[model samples]
Target: MSAATIGGQNGAMPELITIDDVRSAAELLRGTAVRTPLLPCLAGDPDRPLWIKPESLQPTGAFKIRGATNALLRLTKQERERGVVTHSSGNHAQALAYAAKVTGVPAVVVVPYGTPQTKIDAARRHGAEIVQCELAVRQETAEAISRERGLPMVPPYDHPHVIAGQGTAGLEIAEDLPEVELVLVPVSGGGLLSGVATAIKALCPAAKVVGVEPELAADAQASYRSGVLDRWSAEQRGRTIADGLRSYLSELTLAHLRARVDDIVTVTEDEITSAVGWLAHNARLVAEPSGAVPLAAYLNRADELPRGRTVVVVSGGNMDAELFAKLV
Candidate 1:
């Protein structure tokens, strides 16, 4: 189930990140990132007992820290001296800023104009120079900045190091719960899902790894089903309340998903908000809209999922104050 041999359309596949790559990333993230516990969900039935991997508990309040930190740590001293640049919707921006601060690597993040104030402010607080751009031109803006400033571009998800870093969480899950049957992960650019599915499939061969996303921004789901890399426009993706999940998958991530992931599912806007409130009330966890999508799938689409000890990856908790108040 590893992505090592996932064939490509050109009959020549680039080397996919492997379990050993994930393990190496885990070693790099050992002290910097939290080994988040898999807490038993109080809301579970006998047929499908539930557990939550609250990556929201990470230092930057999201699992993006794992990938961000790993990428930063792997950089050469000369590269670090030159600094790094990236573009992100929210969580990864904060994660990269926070990681850069700790490592004394100067960082600049090109964020879209419509990103939440909370996330933008958090990134600034971590000392990243924030550059605002239109949502559609974020990556291009970042690339221009990287070239002009002679800095490395640490992409949010497309890079192998980033995927391997995110895989650390899956490694933890397989180690902690050997008998786990289903793992529900939130999908945006597919960094978390790609790495997690790779690790989960390698460690717990029988366990199923499913990717959950908002129906409004379900390009990955569409791509998975069609066997082609489908993309939703910025206008289409921006309709989702899950700000952290508006980004589309990279070709690398799509390849990883096609090879390792069992299924892809989408939940409604109403279901997303409801799951946000449900986690706060039932589990006392503060899950952002993207983070809550996995729980939304469990609550609303259980009939379509595998039964047994299920693990839901709560990807982040960077909720806006007003939105959190309104939802919970």
Candidate 2:
């Protein structure tokens, strides 16, 4: 497909991210984030073998490190001195905190109340000042903190740098499996999905890029099907077990999804739990519910997916110990 076909010719379309942007991000992330391995899934059918990109192996046990590190590194010296702020349910909060600690910058994080204790502890361990609020007001609270402290806001997603950094994962996938026919990515605010889809589409145009989401929190899938940026209420999305996948997609990410994504699928809650258990047992990979959504979609909706070599991105592993034990 041509760029014009995916990215509309109208001037309203936002500046689309290119392969070059992903390359630059890869360069920036070379020494900062781990190059997660692409391991073959021994449990998957031999007829349609599956590969897993376990981003959980990162220092923060999540893919958020890639974007967080890149964004923090790009800050000017003056901006760094002033510090950075962001709002996240968990993973990005820890990522930013860890990045700030390593870069010698103060960091403030606004997190939703009732977030997994493990994630909150991880952020605290990195020395981030934490402010708690309802998920609905988390963004406003973070913005207020940023303005009050004169700190730049490192948004969890939406920014070009974050998307570019996340795209590096796609670049690795493409490089490792040049013949990969299908790529499954779990969607939340769509940064990872947007970046990965953009990179995969550019590097392997013929490969199918599918975004997976929990059926209870399927706002991204709804937006893709409607061609309108559909959003779900915080209460509605909070019904899912996948704590990290509750956020709605931003306009920037919605634009990329509309252009580059082949399809969006929703997996049931049961399937997500099953996937988490399956990965632990068969792949010996610890996956949070949000991270297991792609594998869930693959296992439950195989009839709808393309048959061939497939890759699923296990986005994070930051579940509470109690929850992990109960689920697995």
Candidate 3:
């Protein structure tokens, strides 16, 4: 854990994302990203009803599209002509590729080895040139590609535009369910959680925004509790079933989380798979392991959370066919 705030080395405080930033991103995403519905969970309790925000319904089958499109839309024409580069485990890779295709901007994606082939194929279908590298060096690899190609690097979660774009989902959640008392979001690189927490806290002041993650990759939980940014090695985070939640946080995301998020919780791998199964059977939603984690926390850690109308963000549905078949 590092106690120093991000940008502290230069005596500068990192700017925390605000509700206005999220609203602007929402504007940028109006027609491009899906304004996914907040559907009632059929199996939810009568007293504490649960709603599902299915970002899986997005064009790219994930919430990453919101940020990816926003970032790309904000690019200068010259930048767009030169193209863009990013590193993602899966979801963001597909998102950036799709956004680039639609916007006529060329894209290159550096993916870590062992990423789901389903996601890789999806990105390729959208016309992104794919590069493979070790998980530890994925970011550096993207930077190298950007340097060599003169493409602007649109990071998966570390950038403000990306974070603000992900926050649009939170804006919708707040708008749709202003009375919501608890909002559950999956945390990996902290972009979604940071943005959602910012929007939810601003729009629904009384709502408790909680971040969920696999216990196998609970660096976010540890960091939230300690008020310091904690890091886990790639090998350690890779132990979880939730591949999308394997990445750790950045200084910008950590700052937003510390300021806006109420709590961070962890769930077991079994619980995560169980939640995925439940969503398939009960909610009729095919949530990937990463997307199912918010529901996992709600199902297993309810006693630790507030009681009220709750919303779980089903972040994405991009799963390997074989794995989806077995889980569902």
Candidate 4:
């Protein structure tokens, strides 16, 4: 199938969702997904202190497992046995692989050749088959694989189940820090942000949701302005030190963000560099470009965030050894 539309006229509403969905997801995925910790920022405004949800501690080293696990669990036994497929460059590939294996099914991941070897190797170690191809052709590659094996394709951040699954992070944030008035999340496919927006809008309607993206790969901010799909070349994608923010957005992801997200901000590569290094050395965390995104946003808008409580989604920690060393 193609990318699923999110929160459209016929799409689901975030307001109507019940916490039972999260409880049920947790029950089905217990012992599978880890309870990633929410660590505090060391040097930010102490009066309105900041905290980070280290989703990088996930089993696949990213927050993707929540959605992938939820998706596989919701499938029929026949569908599960038939296997699943998806297109991802990093976290999603490894997550879907681990989730499928945990659910006793097979999985195939379509990745762009530009994907780092660290990610590919990680996925293989978890028992999934890898299919590499051109970057822009990734969706087509997934379609071909799905057609060949009759497998359902699970996109990185484009399905309702996936969005709700990723949103679980936001639910935990609300529970952990009920006083939080602002939350910042990295923007790539928009599933995590949409899920967080949905949950926060319901549980903490007074809170604001902001998305942080690399200036080199700021398609979400651009698309949110024009209200349409935005394309990016590797150059147009940004030469940011954050390799993970190098792709453009899907139509489905853009639509959901347009519906609920409050603001989109772009941070420079230099800013990302500092944030990544800061997170590693000062925060005692390992963060990739996507992972360091929220910190970049906060640094840019340090004056605007509420003066009391702020939460940032420390999305993933899939950094290469050399990359990590050079970044810090």
Candidate 5:
């Protein structure tokens, strides 16, 4: 059943995304973004083995390119002329910068001060002007810049275009693993999780969609459980080593999570670190802590999850060299 069918039972549907939107985004991203590979985990259960979708292979070293490219492609000529601005902790910043550079549109990114240097450098490399701000004020600062410069804001998440673009990852997963039974997606702002869940549910309705988050930054899990939007203080979320999973979800993403996600799970700092190491050593993939959360869930909470062939979305790999060395 489609989200539209489910939304009708609840009330007037909010502007949620659809499968068609995802297909359109896929068309736009055909030559721009990488259609990352899904590799098998040698150590997983033979009968119900795990596969990893390494989105870190994208040019910006993350899956953010898909949504960023789609959002930019949809911009009107007038809007493109005005340029674009948005806030991100890391991956999305680089994604938008790369997308803007390729499309020949100027871009400005407001990023949290403590974001890894590697991500910041990647954004600058793509010709995007960088604006630094405290975690609490990143969005406000981006909005201020947008208003002052008459730049249209392409939000990191919460927009239909962004969500639809991210959903293309799910479309690929379903197409690659038609008989797959479960998917574990790392959740931060919920764009990736929301988009992946929507596409997976629409294409493979029986497949379970699960979200993974760091226990310290578990706002998405809290919001999913309470049936209300919940947020964590920046300081609280910053306590986790998974810097990319700090943001809270918007109402639009929360709505998608509610409608499509089957379960939300939390992993500890140790699990994240171990998963990062495992990805590098066993899977030959360099995964940032945020991207490792889904694998952490698979390893530490397998008993809690449904029995099936599982696919873990390794969302990004943009950690500092020293940090990567220390973790892996």
Candidate 6:
């Protein structure tokens, strides 16, 4: 779902992309990007034979690398020289760090203090300087870092090039299975949702784009319905089990999700925990809460989905295993 211009402002972000963009991303990332497996649903929703695009198989155990790599690769020589900065919890930070490392560009990551230690080590392994701040102060921290370093900020999901690159996932899914009817994408700041929705809608007009979020942290769903950033009350947001869903909506991402997604559904913390267990125990796949969102949606509202072909984009697989073990 490529976003419309920011309130009719020109050059803020681009519109729906062309096939050439997907092909270009594929070409640029030919040797680097993993052709992650899309397995037949192990859960076997008998009504609709589902498929799981297990992006956990991707390098860094998440799908963010696809967009991050393409974004950094597409940069001009001057842009590359100045380096890049980003604010991310875990997945996107690893993705950007790996991308910058591969392209020989310096990366400074402003991470939330709550980010898992494993993720911090991963970023350090890729040579990204870590600047830690409180989770709620992400934008402010990232902005300060950008000013001090004079580096280009590589927003996780709000940028056009980033969205276009992420859309490649939907384009590939469509190419791989022309009969696909439903595609479930996990939403966070709405980058993957917007990109996948745009690609799916453009290619398979009849297909439904479903966005899933944790019920405790369903601010994106709220924003989609309200046509504005309807953030949760401070109390509710503070208690949501979905720590990764700690940010509010971006105007660019919110507009695209509302216009493109067929429906926005939510899952409880119990359902999310169950989904993670299902992936780990049944499918032998290690998945974080955000990664297991599709499974949560499927299990929570299996009867609501169309009784036809369905595809779920498993967004990431970066759980703190110890934390999950306690939950289970």
Q: Tell me the tens digit of each residue's lDDT in model 2 across 1-328.
A: 0121222335366776888988988987877699998999989878779999999998898899888887887788888888989998678888899988987889998988988776788888999988999977998998898778887888878787888889999999999999999999999999999999989999999999999999999999999988778899878998999988998887778899999999999999999999999999988999999999999988889898998999999999988789899988
* Number of the candidate with higher lDDT, 2 or 6: 2
lDDT of model 6, residue 318: 73
Runs in model 5 with CA error above 4 Å?
1-13, 112-118, 133-136
The Cα local distance difference test for each model comes to: 0.90, 0.88, 0.89, 0.79, 0.89, 0.78
TM-score of every model versus the real structure: 0.94, 0.93, 0.94, 0.90, 0.93, 0.90
Write out the backbone clash pairs for model 6: 1-194, 1-198
Give residue 218's error in model 2 in angstroms. 1.1
Model 2 quality (TM-score): 0.93
The true-versus-predicted C-alpha distance at residue 73 of model 1, in Å, is 1.0
The TM-score, computed over Cα atoms with residue i paired to residue i, of candidate 1 is 0.94
Model 3 TM-score, 2 decimals: 0.94
Model 6 over residues 1-328: C-alpha lDDT tens digits? 1232333344343254455676677677655568776678757677778788888877888888878888888877887888889998768899999888987989999988877788899999999999999978987999887778777778887776777678778877888877889898888678788888888888888999998888887888888988767877767765656555555667777777877889888888888888888887767787778888877888778776655788888887777768778655
Off by over 4 Å in 4: 1-23, 304-306
**What is residue 255's positional error in candidate 1, in angstroms?**
0.6
Q: Candidate 3 residues 1-328, lDDT tens each?
A: 0121233346455887678889988988887788899999879877779999999999988999998888888888898888999988678888999988988889999998988787788899999999999977987998888878888888888878888899999999989989999999999989999999989989999999999999999999998888777899878998999989988887788888888998898999999999999999999999999999999988899888888999999999988889999997
Task: Choose the strongest candidate by lDDT.
Answer: 1
Residue 22 CA displacement from its true place in model 5, Å? 0.5
Q: Candidate 4's residue-wise lDDT over 1-328, tens digit each? A: 2234343445444332345665566667777888777788778777768898999889888888998998888788888889999998877888999998888879999989878787788788888999999988999989998888899988777677787778788888887877778899988778788778877776787888888888778888889889876877768775677666666666656766777678888788888878888887767888887889888878776775544578888888887788788888
Model 6 off-target regions past 4 Å?
1-20, 134-136, 233-235
